[model samples]
Target chain A: MDSEYLGYAAGILTTVAFLPQAMQLIRTRQARDISLTWAATMTAGVFFWLCYGVAKQSVPMISANGITLLLLLVILFIKLRYQDSTDTGEK
Target chain B: MDSEYLGYAAGILTTVAFLPQAMQLIRTRQARDISLTWAATMTAGVFFWLCYGVAKQSVPMISANGITLLLLLVILFIKLRYQDSTDTGEK
Candidate 1:
């Protein structure tokens, strides 16, 4: 297969892979085993990746990381909400 | 900053990001809230990414994804081990 095809495949698969995680969190409504540090770290990492893509002018990286960033942010948001929901429930 | 630096930063940060996740799983000794599907999907995706790296002859991609694939495989192994541990505990 062409290298471009490989890049596309990698981009699509990796980008789509994050969906299961986000969906699982949403469906289960639990992230007890997931480290907040991991979520935050993944967000920061992917942000740089997106910026890297922009610098390289690679559409696949830019598009994939762009979507992945949004997904990670949603995951982060949910995690933050769930983490504090109990503490704030009484208020 | 150079695009090379951006690539390096993205590669380094993203590669290091998985360590916390693996550490979290090991420390907690629990995978209850983690999605088996996510673990599996991530492994497969990273495998393709590694292949993409090889095809492109990109040292950063190769090095980063290689480490990520190993980490993900470890995670998948643990998730598999945990998911069935109770059922198999009877033996």
Candidate 2:
């Protein structure tokens, strides 16, 4: 019932939400078809969330967004790298 | 400087972040490598965020997560369907 607990719960839940996509991307190493617009948008959202968390000094927000950002970054990188390679026909 | 503007800014940013990924997935119609676990986890997070938003009566949180939940649902559905089709080998 505590606010802290509530925030933590939210953090954990949201973090896990990203797991399915993250795991899939990591395993396959293919991100060519994913939407550049969508990923870019989400990254912006996470960045704002991180900033908001900092501004509000909300630990839950900070932790959750930080981790989400990292996960997203990985996905984004895979997507870009895959596209780059495919375009170059390196693999 | 208003809180409303700040919240909206965050929402837009995060939403845009997901743009790239969403676009890629939609264009290629490929969700084979995405992880079920990660998607489930992200769903949970969004669910909690929705709950928290409701409890707190935070319009910004509610709006952002509501849209996010919908987007994620689409991705999840595509992934499942793709797997099902691949399993059946009808395509």
Candidate 3:
């Protein structure tokens, strides 16, 4: 396969990986164990990656980051919503 | 800034975002709340990403995926290690 295909395969794998967590969170409404910092930082990071993809004109990067950004935002929102109730006092 | 710089910045942000979770996992020895499916799938996905980076000869992708893969592995290991003890019964 071509390198571009490889990139897309990799992107698909990474992007799909988030689905299980997102679905679980949506179903259970539990975000106590997840790190807020990780979610927030990842959201920012993915946003930058979307920008990078635009700059590079790479479809794989753009598509993957776009979807991943939405996933991260979902996780982040869950984290924030449940933040008060599920305090582990770690952060 | 150059597009390359944007790529690097994006890579850095995403890579660093994993640290907080990793650190917290190490400190608390708690993996009950983390999704095993997420960690395992992410590890596999990141491994593919490293391969993709190698194929593309992209320094940022290689470096970022390399570190992220290791971090995922750490999380996976923790999840597996504590899998029996802290069963949330959600799996």
- Model 3 per-residue lDDT at A22: 85
Fnat for candidate 2 (0 to 1): 0.61
Best-first order by lDDT: 3, 1, 2
Candidate 3 per-residue lDDT, tens place, A1-91, comes to 6776766677788798788888878877767668889999889988998999999898878989999999888888988986566434334
Cα lDDT of all candidates, in order? 0.78, 0.67, 0.81
- Estimate candidate 2's alpha-carbon lDDT, on a 0 to 1 scale: 0.67
Regions of model 2 farther than 4 Å from truth: A1-6, A84-91, B1-6, B16-27, B84-91
Which 10-residue span in candidate 1 chain B carries the lowest summed lDDT? B82-91
Candidate 1 residue lDDT tens string, A3-62: 777767777877887888888778766666677888898899899989998988988789
What's the TM-score of each model vs. the native? 0.86, 0.76, 0.87
Q: How well is candidate 1 docked (DockQ)?
A: 0.44
* Cα lDDT, model 1, residue B33: 56
Candidate 3 positional error at B36, Å? 1.7
Q: How close is candidate 2 to the true structure, as a TM-score?
A: 0.76
CAPRI class assigned to model 3: medium
For model 1, residues B2-91, the per-residue Cα lDDT tens digits are 777877777787788888888877775666556787788778888888898888898877889999999888778778877554321121
Better of 1 and 3 by lDDT: 3
> In candidate 3 chain A, what residue range of length 10 has the lowest lDDT sum?
A82-91
